[model samples]
Target chain A: MTAKAAMRKQFTLNPAALEQLFSVLESHDFQIVGPTIRNGTIQYDYIKGCKELPSGWTSEQERASCRLKRRKDDALFGYVPGADSLKRFLHPPELRLFRAERENGVFRILDNPAPAPKLAFVGVRSCELRALSILDRVLAEDRYPDAAYVAARRRIFIVAVNCTEPAPTCFCTSMGGGPEAGGGFDLLLTEIVSDNQHVFVAEAGTSEGSGVLAVLNPGEVTKEIMAALHEAMDRSKAAFKREVATEGLRELLYESFDHPQWDRVAAQCFLCANCTMVCPTCFCVTVEDSTDVPVRRAERWRKWDSCFTQNFSYIHGGSVRLSPKSRYRQWLTHKMAAWVDQFGTFGCVGCGRCITWCPAGIDVTEQIAALRGTAAPAASDGAG
Target chain B: MNSDTGMKPKIAIFKFASCDGCQLSLLELEDSLLDLVNAVEIAYFPEASRRMLKGPYDIGLVEGSITTHHDAERIQRVRRESKTLVTIGACATAGGIQALRNWKDVGEFVRFVYAKPDFISTLKMSTPVAEHVPVDFELRGCPINKLHLVELIGAMLAGRKPNIPTYSVCMECKRRGNVCLAVSASLPCLGPVTQAGCGAICPAYHRACYGCFGPMENPNPTALAGRFEAQGHADRDIMRAFRMFNAWSWQFRQVSEERERR
Candidate 1:
């Protein structure tokens, strides 16, 4: 049998067996990281087992607000991406490049050398996986490869969950990313909850995943389980409230640079850069050098930057995008148009984090709809 | 002057008509304070030490706002003596929270706050140091960030321009991967128009940005104000948001006036 066929063996894992999967990953010296409720928000952190997952909880997300709500049943991976992402662990917000110390007029530079930690990410969403893949392409380009990113990425083992309950903010379907995970995971899971049973239909995508499955010794994945998995995925696909039409979106954005819609959207944009910050694909950075008062020692560091910032396009004379209209235009057009030219794929994964997390409640779908001259769904007014 | 072979740069810290928060920020650099002392001569800093050194200083770190006639003249002397004049904190960079009085009558404010209103000698408008004298650079924040302060000192010592950003707080928020408090929660945030420095602290804690660091390079406060209006915010609330820490800042002042007109 082919490797793909052999790895495609599926089984139904009960709650106890799922716990064993965590133990198996632990045995391989991988620190298990998963979602947990902390400070009234879903944050990714170190977890011992499935107990740490946000069970019996769901998140209500809208433009600029997120709230954790109680669910009728206990579903571990019921929520979508929170404020945090794989970028935090991989690229990191602040990275020290090197430290320089002047000794006897001779400047000696010491490079920051830290090894990447081996981590097993549990309950990673499909859109997030697509985002990680997008980052992989950006950070691992032949011209300028990030050593830290490559190391962290190589050490990660993803445990993806196919969405049975996608958040209202989700539009992964339109982006051709999700509702169902296609690839880019070590193991994939589909949860099914019936009257008497709660089981996960597990499928291994790699040898490592299959090894963990072997340890779990799950029950046989009968035809009924397969049907349940399909039903769950379909339910998720139907749950998406918004859809972004990507057909000729690149060409449209490129041609409509001066669209009146730009001015309309710019009026609402705070240029606070929350959209770029929360975006899974947005990767801009800035460098800074710091030294002690005596100028004896200095260190260079790199931090995350955004296009929405005036200095991002600044040269010797002045900033390139002086007005909010131009800055908003630059960001949207880059994501929809220039990204395809640069990365060979659409920049946005239609995750809707940008829409839900906007303090102004600016919806990307609505903005795009305006650009396309189509009537969008009435913008959510925060009313139930 | 110490005429040793390795002559460290002479640095001084000055304050005007505001809180001493930014001066405390320099002391808050506990880890690097000793290193800083070793790198430069603290020629004059009343906040840190009592020993006041006369100037012809290499770097003058000015804090607070120009809110009195005495301060208005004092800054000119500071400008003449210092080779490089750097303004630290919102007060020195953009007139700070005290500038809110600029919209109203300062005399009324003096009468309300002080028992002896006639004894108070204050300018009608609280203004930044740059308004009176040329500033080499302006380090922004309510109390400027210690990291940026260190970077500024380091760059000055190295005889190079400091690498301070003119970006919005939105960039810092994104870098930290925090959700947008304004968009997600329908809160009024000035982060888009405010400069990046405070590391998006307010939003991380589920509060909107108050524009403590002032208007970023070429900000559009009118656009953000329109957003606030569309989100069912009252005109007064939108106006109050702009009239906070950086009220007297040109961009915010203009936007606030525009909203009032509307």
Candidate 2:
């Protein structure tokens, strides 16, 4: 790497230069997966270029609610994180482990030969970046690592976007994650849009990122650019009025095992596994094996599982966490407390997916606060 | 009786009171049909074949609900004849849409709708096959997923547990990257309390899942009802949602009754 590429640098980019960034990735045969409008929500999908991005759309999120609305201006990264994150791409919902066939009564196993694709993930948020790091701790560095996850993580290039717009449900600030792109990205972008100009203040976090920017030859970051970046970030930071209160959270949750609050929450909890499925750091998986009777061929598949499912806790005779109360308690305690004991970091990055995607508006942050005795459980408004 | 049917396992398909859509799922297995035929001896299937063989069968795939007094008695004999009695479709598993009569007066309906009410021989309520006989397995869905039927047959032959997930439809929806209609569009969906089997077809096409597959393992329908209420769905509408294909399922039945009371 050149000396200039070795050192982290910042640059200013216009809409045209942003388009060039996509071209650079395309030139290297990277499949660009970014946020796009689908099913009345902004979700991640394969995109050809910035044209496919949800440019003029923004998401309105609340507890158990999300709706996409048209923005006055065409800002590419205007919305907060939706139902998807990098987890969908890195650790897919279903993956074939192996295929086995018996010939002459001798069984032979064949490893799934599907190669991981080179992926360029754009419009990644700060919480998502932390989520990836947290997932790496489980799926990559664990005693028994997931080979498929490792393979998928191998050829990924992240184009992280610093959040300037955080949803009402977002609590990244509480989980030690802020709107700013701290690290774990090749290139970082801070979108600054106004009536006059729509530009991105970009920075290289790696040599490869710098090399990509070198091709575009973006302008030097000016005073005006820094001011715009700071202004937008300040607005976002100020928006996070609520927090999880992580201080002594682990101990609090452990002590509150028999807390009546659990029953209250469970009363409205669907136990549908939506919270866990949408969770970025939830790496729990279950394996299924099926055989073709005629062909004498069998295959094993690993599928994403959730603690919310009764079958998830099944042990021989019956499931351990039988009640919805117990299941909800297990999920919250594990995410906030046990994850720290295991991974040295909390599981939740405060993405608020569990809140926004919950059929019942059972907010985790609110639950934590209620458990802490700082707030009373919201009176069951008769409608959850 | 096919006593000398060689080493191949004997399979029988029986129908009761249903739309025959579940049995059609078997015929819809265009490619797997040949493989299934080669793997098992289809001793009896009235829908597909005229050769009605008696049993002592290995696996009896029963479709539809026990709507008549005759069907209720017939299921007992079917259970005794088959080594493994597997109920297929919502009708046999949870009492199909026909079981909506369980909430109403069946006699009044027979009198009102039929010209010859005295001639009609019917039970007070439509009931699942499991109510009469101990079912070894119950393949769910209004028209059971063909892939699931194939998997069940394959597993029975292999002497292994079928890989049919009892988890909620939300699992499959998330796997398919379907934006939660309940959350995003405020559409009252039964996916949370419903079982996973249909590959989340309804949600994928931008409609709420109507719970055709029946209640999931440990379903929290009351909790889902609360959510629906929060979304401004009327109690009657919420009740009607559960009173669909698998309406007689106890989990869904209890919740629908609760809604009606309100």
Model 1: residue A116 alpha-carbon error in angstroms: 0.6
lDDT by residue for model 1 (A1-384), tens = 135534577788988887888888998999988988865768787899888989888788766678878988888877876877788888887899888888887988776658889999998888988898889889986478989899898998889888887766778888877677777899888888877668998888878888788788888988888788778878888788877899999999998988999888777777777777778888788887776666677888888777877778889897888777888888888888898899888888888888876766678888888899998855444431
**Model 1: per-residue Cα lDDT over B1-262, one tens digit each:** 2223588779999988768988898899997888888878899999889999899898899999999999999999999999989998889988998888787899888899999888999899999898999998888888788889988887766666677777788878767656566645567778888888888899888888888888987677887887788778988888889987778888989989888877
- The pairs that clash in candidate 2 are B91-B96
Which residue runs does candidate 1 get wrong by more than 4 Å? A1-7, A141-143, A377-384, B1-5, B109-118, B177-180, B183-186, B204-207, B226-233, B258-262
Query: Which is the leading candidate under lDDT?
Result: 2
Q: Taking the tens digit of each residue's C-alpha lDDT, what string does model 2 give over B186-253?
A: 89899998999999999999899999999998888998887788778999999999999999999999
**Once superposed on the true structure, which residue ranges of model 2 sit more than 4 Å away at CA?**
A1-8, A376-384, B1-6
Error of 2 at A119 (Å): 0.2
DockQ of each candidate, alpha-carbon based: 0.54, 0.65
CAPRI-style class, candidate 1: medium
The estimated TM-scores of all candidates read: 0.91, 0.96
